[model samples]
Target: MLDWTTVLVIVLMAASTYATRVVGFVVLRDRTLSPRMQAIMQNVPGCVLISVIAPAFVSSRPADLLGLAVTLAAAMRLSLLPTVVIGVVATGLLRHFVG
Candidate 1:
């Protein structure tokens, strides 16, 4: 049902993902990273998380924005459980009253 270009693109993506996972082990098997590389690696997860969430924040409703603000603040000051609970409760309440 899929065209060749779509299939090729999907295959390429899968192969690239697989290569990234395997290449780290192959390339770094015997050596350690430099300090700069280590710092860059440490930041990768946060950068990726922001990349995934940035688009949603741009497109969200006002109520959702309020919820996200509470969530971000809670996340920075509190812990995961409280952050998630605050996000959910804040969004629900805002949606009920303002939405």
Candidate 2:
């Protein structure tokens, strides 16, 4: 059932993403970022996450909408890490059960 090309693409994409993150740390290893820059960097990941997830909100799919509702509820009560885990698990479950 596995498509080798799709699997290769996914592996390459994951490797590139990991490399960029690692490179960022290596490049910044000797430099001290300004407070403002640090704050901006801190929010970059959250902003990226929002950009990725925002389009799904427009999809009008029940599973996505309900998963978002669950994620939002989790976010209100949990920290960012747990919220992300909950959101991912909730979305997968919703998709399986509702679709």
Q: Please report the candidate that would top lDDT against the real structure.
A: 2
Q: Residue-wise lDDT of candidate 2 within 1-99, one digit each (tens)?
A: 999999999999999999999999999999999999999999887787677668778877899999888888887898778888898999999999998
What is the Å distance of residue 20 in model 1 from its true position? 3.8
For each candidate, give its TM-score against the true structure.
0.51, 0.86
**Model 2 backbone overlap count:** 0
TM-score of structure candidate 1: 0.51
Clashing pairs in 2: none
| Models, CA RMSD each | 6.4, 1.5
Positional deviation of residue 32's Cα in model 2 after best superposition, in angstroms: 1.0
- Give per-residue CA lDDT, model 1, range 1-99, as digits (tens): 779999999999999989997998798889889999899977776575556446649855888788778778887997556766787788789889878
lDDT of each: 0.78, 0.88
Candidate that would win on TM-score = 2
